[model samples]
Target: IDLETYIYWSGDIGRQFAEALAERARAAVKVHVLIDWIGSRKVDSRDLAMMREAGVEVEKYNPLVWFNLARLNHRDHRKLLIVDGEIGFIGGAGLADIWQGNADAPNHWRDTQFRLEGPAVGQMQAAFMDNWTKTTGRVLDNEDYFPELRPAGDHYAQVFFSSPRDGTETVRLMYLLAIAAAQKNIRLSASYFVPGALTTEELVDASKRGVNVEIIVPGAKTDVPIARYASRSKWGPLLKAGIKIYEYEPTMYHCKVMIVDDVWVTVGSANFDNRSFRLNDEANLNVYSAEFAAEQARAFEEDKTSAKLISYKEWKNRGLCTKLLERILAPFRSQL
Candidate 1:
């Protein structure tokens, strides 16, 4: 198990998850957990002590060390749960109270997680082990974690990951390549949508070439208003080029998904922003099956019903105060 945020709250969803892991550990399941140090700041040390006493091996990724200050900004934002080399789960949801419930209340955030049981599970395990070895300096290379898997379905899928150590721009390059190859339509759902100049240009060009492009982003219920401001600053060209953008209205929208041509789909931790593409370690599952893509596209359309579209005229004639905020935060777009 690897997560960015693993908050521990008493008598809630967080408690339920913590106790489950502890129970498994007490049963001699050989559980190993990895969580980000900064992201888990809300975690109680008592819970960690309980799990440790139960025989769970837990480690924090990139703890504050004087010599490691250079890489402090780069975090392990990947969310992965691989069980016995057979089942794997990946997505943007973290183990916290905010991610609980069915998005029925404002406190319950909207998110998505995908479960897998196929040949691609091996790759997902490897993605987890990549950081595990780096953090613990011990390789978990055995049949318990790398058992042979058979084809569970007919979908052609690939689980890929990117980190600052391997390359800074691999996730960005993957998104650009998929966007450039789109010939029919693009349905993008981004929690944070701060696209740089080149990505903005590509979307505008795709719109010009008659590809139906639409994006969904967080509106007033965002966790990072500065990111939303920076994202809006770059949307003038896209809106002018006839690309439709929508803002979700209910609660915090924390889904990261992109579907192109109704046949190719990518979903996971990486958002459509510089922080995810260049600064943090991210993972995504790309599925090349029309059947699966069609299901996801239908879900995207369902989500659109809860969103309100932003017109170019409205964006152009916005209030001066809002425009001022965008300009003030424009220089820090990369950091957002």
Candidate 2:
């Protein structure tokens, strides 16, 4: 329920979904709503009021306290929606009013989510149930909460959850393992470029070893200017190591995707930044099918046409004052 993972689909799309979901709920579709207190603090009160009146059981995960710094860092960064517990939506996408635009509508905020209908739905529900227990301090063993979900589509999938709470090195190690398993090329597009040292080193080393590694990030303006500048400082290392870099010329790029050797693709709210890996509670899907990887790779190739390549020569010429600033923040990347 953090504000960052909201779905933006205004106009007819927004009105239609609101009516549809409300009707289904009224007809006895069990609804389980979970929001992060810290992230959703700025969320409008009117929406919560409406959901409450509609009988949707809404609860906030980890309402932040000034003293619990550790608790505050571990946010429920996952944005998931399961309709009928059969059809599930997971990724950075949220069900907030506006999520759809006309196809090729040039949506500024690029995002990705998979409409999953399989055994994975049960796993998704279980993940939510675990979080629900952690925050609510009560186990939810009710069968109604977790329906006997079955696969309605022909797709093989797995749920990969990440967080500091899970382990000290799982997310970081998992990322590197995915990279190591790649055979051809890697395409990564993220909102923030900052990363853990091992990941930062792995990316450069991958390119140096002749792997086709390409990174697409925000050009100059984005939701977080500090992160943009922080990324610029590291471009020199990545470029020298032979990794190609590009800046999306259009609206702020925010999609976090990794397509590797046409086998695995990582899609979720987890940015390739330090905070996402070491701090926040993140949920992502590591799809192992070649077909799914191809579709995602096609989208990356299409985006490449619009993004501008940032050459190493251009970065070296930036004034010393700005370069100094990026260097100052680069060391503290993990804390961001």
> lDDT scores for all predictions?
0.87, 0.70
| Top-TM-score candidate index | 1
lDDT for model 1 comes to 0.87
Encode model 2's per-residue lDDT on 36-143: one tens digit a residue.
776666565655565566666667877767788668767777767765556667776654432453113334455677777777877776667767777667665556
TM-score to native of every candidate shown: 0.97, 0.88
With a 3 Å backbone cut-off (N, CA, C), the pairs that clash in candidate 2 are: 8-98, 8-99, 9-98, 9-99
The list of candidate 2 runs beyond 4 A from truth reads: 1-23, 66-69, 95-107, 149-154
Give me the candidate number with maximum lDDT: 1
Error of 1 at 295 (Å): 1.2
- Each prediction's total of clashing residue pairs, residues at least 3 apart in sequence or on different chains, is 0, 4
